[model samples]
Target: MTGEPILEVRDLCVDYGLGDRAVRAITDASLTLHRGEVLGLAGESGSGKSTLAYALTRLLRAPGVITGGEVRFHGRDGSLDLLAADAAALRRVRWNQISVVFQSAMHALDPVARIDAQLTDALRAHRSGLTAEQRTGRAVELLRLVGIDADRLRSYPHELSGGMRQRVMIAMALALDPEIVVMDEPTTALDVVTQREILTELMRLKDELGFAVVFITHDLSLLVELADTIAIMYAGRLVERGPARELFEGPRHPYTVGLLDSFPALHGERVRMEGIPGSPPALTALPTGCSFHPRCPFALERCAVDFPPTATPAGGSAVRLAACWLHEGGRELPAPLARSLGSTL
Candidate 1:
């Protein structure tokens, strides 16, 4: 979109638990979200995608601690360090400048309260200048914006359908017209058709409102259609990142290639479903050197002794970055990898 960056996350590290038992859930994860750009954070479960999102917004609870790094939020007023922002400052920024549509929309809403009340409460908390009547009018408009009727404003969360409730959550998040929105698997439980509908509506809204989105999900296939840039995370670290089209066309990292193969081809000759072998390594007991080396088919002798450096892949544009020794040259990659991503390297 060639827009100014609305949010920048640099070297963010997060952990869980006490010293001896601490697990590094996020390590040196960095990316930027431009105005109106959709940056997809894709990874398997426990890959630290959501952790990065939560840590950036300072929503991580006790036991989940941000150990290092910075979250710089560029808002209308100016630049503000989100990690260092105090309670009052955070209160002012959150909801007004940034908001989150958390995973599981059902859990996000209050079962007993009417949808209108939830929407107004957000407005009442952040936008005190709006009169009660104005807030109510805005609530109805928000529902309409999300393709829901104003008549449903009186309906409780439990009374609405899954898609409707999700739409309500989205409405609540956009109530303040925040500059950035963090959506963590916002369409997880919805049907494929419903999920497509919600995402289509979301992108339309984004185009209309010009708000940056940090969309976190495990579905790289879906991101290919919705995201402008995609960042792949593994074992608490970002393994590869590039434009969505380039990453899908020629993924340099073995993990990224495996992830692409895991999903069925939407518009190609049929191919067998090939899932990644072995389970993700536990953060507490991560393997030595590359955390993915234990399972990587292209693992070399050096892969066991030293961690791969995050650098530009061979012949790849500076925009394409990957952490894999294969990109550094000298190591002979597997025949299959060399055949599939030879140009990428």
Candidate 2:
């Protein structure tokens, strides 16, 4: 986390569809991923976590567009605005400087192709002048890096387990040794134990390889354990961002609080699971002020009409930032909200 940021996203905005039909999937979402650091993106579905990742890499299709903001990649060569990069430049950046592990690793892979071919194809595209032997060797090394044996490389996607498929996707992502990896819910369908193992392995690999990671998931508890920092999003806006443990222990935004409440404590006295009321608002017609206000218990009258500005709390966490009216004008939070935050339940 001490190293310089490998990727810097500033005022990044994304929209889906065209003209009046366009819905804002992400608005003013910004984040920085330092070299070798793991930054977790936690939000409910439709909060634009995956959209932000795809937008960052310029992988959006016809309906999805990057209307505003910049995604800068500061790699060993230099800094480049990814949004403005032409196809040729983008090809050089993808998998060479940055790579992505799609949501469904099984589906992401070519069912017809063996694991070895998929891994080598990435190498062949990016790393030119490599002989057959060299490519095969690199493929083996990559599989090994992800805790997969060389024998599995010959196996087809169907022959491998879900975890193996995920690791294979990860292995392919790391084939070029990119400085950053953007993963979109890479552990979605795996069992709990397998999910934990994969996350642990991913962190270990990140540390060893010295590559930053933008890990997106709906599981806040997993993020708290693996990410160095966590960013909580609601209705496409980042409502809170801070170190993982601090945000988990004392979330500043009501949305974040509700997300935490949804998960049961692993060690402490068990508490009833409480889900956030109502579904996430439709992007086509978002609320006027703070988007979370409709479901936020602490919402004040001002929250209905005025969008809250991002502010650091009075106590001043090292890098905590919350966009909420409670912190506006340096005002202390209402006693009830503060009291609720302090309570174990």
User: Per-candidate TM vs. native?
Assistant: 0.96, 0.96
Residue-wise C-alpha lDDT for candidate 1, range 230-258, written one tens digit per residue: 99999999999988887877787889988
Error (Å) of candidate 2 at residue 256 is 0.6
Worst 10 residues of 2 by lDDT: 336-345
lDDT of 1: 0.89
**Cα lDDT tens digits for candidate 2, 181-290:** 99999999999898888988998998898898999999998898788999998999988998887787677788888898898876888667877888899998899999
Question: lDDT per prediction?
Answer: 0.89, 0.88
How big is the positional error of residue 345 in model 2, measured in Å on the Cα after superposition?
7.2
User: Which residue pairs show backbone clashes in model 2?
Assistant: none
Please give the TM-score that candidate 2 achieves against the real structure. Answer: 0.96
Q: List where candidate 2 sits over 4 angstroms from the true fold.
A: 334-345
How many backbone clashes does every candidate have?
Answer: 0, 0
